[model samples]
Target: MRIALIGRPNCGKSTLFNQVAGYKAETGNFHGTTVTYTESKVRVLGEVVDLVDLPGTYVLGGSNPAEKVSHDYLGDHPVDVIINVIDATFLAQSLELTLELLRLDKPVLLAMNMMDEVARLGIKLDGPALEKELGVRIVPVVASKGRGIKALFLEAKRAAEQGILQPRFDDFQDDPYSRHKAALQLSQRFAVQGQRTLSWRDRLDDIFLHPAYGYVALAGVLLLFFQAVYGVGQLIEPPLLALFDSLITNLNTYIDTGNLLGVLLNGVLQGVMAGFAIVLPYLFPFLLGLGFLEDVGYLPRIAFLMDSLMHRIGLHGKAIVPFILGYGCNVPAIMSTRTLEDSRERFIAAALSTLVPCAARLVVVFGLVAFYLGPLYAFGLYLLNLFIIALTGRILTRLLPENTPGMILEMPPYRIPTLRAVANKAWFRIREFIVEAWPTLIFGSAALGLLVFFDIAKYFNWMVRPITWLLDLPAEVGVPLIFGVLRKELSLIMLGQALGNNDYSAVLSNAQLFTFTVFVVFFVPCVATLVMLKRELGSRQMVWVTLITIIIAMGAGLAARIFGLLL
Candidate 1:
């Protein structure tokens, strides 16, 4: 049997999907989390069942990807049962979608999810009456907490067996008399309150969705997120270092060999180990925290907040999520801009995303600046990334023709996200990172290993001597820069190895580290990003971005060095 989960945005549908399907898929409180449908299988009630989690849509009729996908799925490949998940606290609004689904004549089951929130808000639902009126089983559930799922599953099986999954349609339009008559009839049977009460949530929505405070709250929240990433990321680093130390010692003892071969092995192991210990732990945990915030329904508020700014910059506010995700890695963020409706917007967003300093790059800035220039300089480098993105967006907006983007976004009230769903989303994204980035990381490490093993670093150091003279950086720094093109974070690790110590200040002055960070920040994105740029924007744009980035990075390096001379 095939069971389909459907709902409007942020109705706990994805969370419930994870719970029942026993798999990880992306679940964000943002509107476009599941742009594509995801399928998984699970056995319930002694029967094998396929479950599909469809994209969230406000209505069944729309041109947006999610809406079209949902409509297409229902019309062409109809499911045996339709689980219409709804936010219990906002029954009136969510029921609108449920009403549309009922028209499809499937075996519709109303899963009133987030029931705990409903009760917390002192709202009551007459489930039996609702079931009778809708002519289907209505199950109240707290899907995140695993409440009422067994009973819901049993009802779904019975509905499938009885073949009562036929859709019911009600059209109340134009004629007020007919509309009143239908509504009254349904009300009598359903026992629904004539109108929802004016509650604190309503007042809160008025404020949060307000034009001014909403955006202010958005900026404030974003600032907090960045600070948390920096602070919490630091707090977690020492433990990760200890773990890497243990792995390295154990591996060395087990692989007891001698001479140059052992050195090669150690180099590969060290590079791979550093990639996992330093980069992956920091990147994954930070992403998980961001994912949790997104799952809890905060990102759209950010979109809404940045809508004006995004519009001014020739893009939509919805582009911000992908841009922020770019801080983790530009490749996925660039790919994610596919969610944007406008091709022009996607291009601009993609271009800007690559410029944002991803965590891999951030690791470079933090390592160099904190060690040589102090914590303030390290933090400034981060702010500089945001500044550059904003400045670039503004310039790009002016360069392009004006296009007004539409916003038909719904802001779901915040709810405590299910741990299962959050974990699933984090793991899913992390898995994507591993698949897309790990190979590049391993290869970059191996390539650096080969260069070091074969003494190619000496040649590269000589080759970069002229550039180093201009930039006032030591020739040795070129070794890191060459490998940096392969992976940004690896440059820092390579710098540590080349310097023969974690403290780079002993080798290069503070000004040199500053120039290096600026150059690395503006330099070409990692190989993964370059490939994605080629894939998404074609070879022409990729080539142009590369040329422009190299010019800017070198120019910035020269200027920083020149300014230091003046000082």
Candidate 2:
């Protein structure tokens, strides 16, 4: 049997899905975390069942892409049971979607999640009365803590087995407003008020949502995050690189460097070394920190605080969500643009997001620029990238003028991030990068090594000599530039290999190094991001974005060269 989990955004549907499925699907206190559905199979009551976690939506008739995904999935697929999770504190508001689910005539076991919040608020809900009134089984649960989860699933299995149909009601209304009124009446009948007290969540929100101090807190938090990433990376990189170097040296003692087999082995070893030494060290800590912030509900607040600054670029503050996600990967960042209602905003966001330095690009910036020039230069590159993104956003906004809408974001109560959830999310994101990117890096490296071994690199370099001269880089840099389109990290990895060693100081001067970093930072995005841009913005817009980035990258590189000379 196939069961579907549906709920309004941040209503603990994903938390329930994680508990029931026994695998982490990314969960956040903000909307658009689950831009796509995820599926897992689990045994419930000795029966193997397929479970799907759908993207959150407020109503069946909503227009956003996430909503359309939920709506279309339900319409196209045959779901045996629907597990509609709702926030217990906001029963009436959640029931607006609940009522729409009932019209589908499917068996739905309403999981009233976040009951802990309800209890903390001193709200008393009569579960039996709600079940009876709604004509469905109501299981109160605190999904994050795993409270009442087994019982919830048991009831879900029973409902699925029994083929419970939608209850017949003479006064049932089909519209949102009518259903909202009906839900409120039901809540009043079943819910009782008790003495209220402010919890720690309420206390923290006071300072976190403060207009002035909140910005200070945000900056402090971001500072610590980057410091942790850089510090941890520094601690791990030397030992890891040394280990790989030792292994490669020992292996080379037995192999002849003049043969094809030796060439392939060297190429593979270099790629493996780059993946470990350059990418993993930094990527792991970054994702771990990002997952923690997202799970703890701080990311939305960042968006809220940045709304004022974002308006200057003609984007809603909500654009920050995708911008932050872009730091991890640009593909999903572009996909998350669906959360925005306006096509113009989405287009502008997409254009700027693709330019954000992803983990791969960061590997280049830190491993090449920072390792040689110092941390300050690497840090400057990040700031420069942001300035470019803002400038690009401003340009696009003017080119495609539209009225920007006010942001309406729900700030979820802060919760302590669980180590298990954070680890799972971090591993999931890291696994995606390793699985998709490493092979491309390895193949490109091996292919380039072969070209050099066969003495054909000079021809390739000659082909891109004009570009290298334009940027004032060496002819050897041309090979990496050509392959960088496949994967950004390949540029740095191939650069080391192309120059015959990782010691770049021997080949490129400080000015050349800075110029190269600037070019790679703003150049055309990786192939994966390009495909996503094409999908989201169509071929015409994708072409324009591609051209714009190329122009910007060349211009930036030339300007950096001139500045370096003046210095």
Best by TM-score: 2
- TM for every model, in the order presented, reads 0.82, 0.96
> Residue 435 of candidate 2: its Cα lDDT?
91
Clashing pairs in 2: none
Off by over 4 Å in 1: 73-78, 103-106, 165-167, 170-224, 236-260, 418-440, 457-487, 498-502, 530-567
Listing every candidate in turn, what is its Cα RMSD in Å to the true structure after a full C-alpha superposition? 4.5, 1.8
lDDT of 2 by residue, 1-567 (tens): 889999989897888888878655778778878877888998887888999999989898778777789999998889989999999888888888888887777899899988888887888999887777778888989888889988988888888889866563325678878988888887887777789887787788677768998888887887798778888898998789889888888988997867888888789888888898888999999999988988888888888889988998889889899999898888889999989888888888898998999888888888877888888888888888889888888887788877877788777778787888888888988888789889888888888889889999999899989878988899999899889989999999999889987778889998898999899988999898889999888999898889989988988888889977964
Task: Report the number of clashing residue pairs per model.
Answer: 4, 0
Which run of 10 residues does model 1 get worst, by summed lDDT?
187-196
lDDT of 1 at 283: 72
lDDT of each: 0.73, 0.86
lDDT (10s digit) by residue, model 1, range 1-567: 888888877777777877777655566777777766888888887888888888877677756555678888878785899888887766666666766666565788888898887666655568776776667788989888889888888888787778764435465543435444554555444433444556675676566667888767666766676666666656766577678778877887876534566656766776776666666656766677777787667777777777877776678778887887787678768877767777677778888888888878877776676545766776776776667667777877787775656765667667566676666766776677577556666666556556766778779989878777778877777888877887787788777666655447877777888888888988888888899899878999888778767776777778677755653
Candidate 2's C-alpha runs over 4 A off are 22-24, 165-170
Backbone clash pairs in model 2 (N, Cα, C under 3 Å; residues 3+ apart or in different chains), count = 0
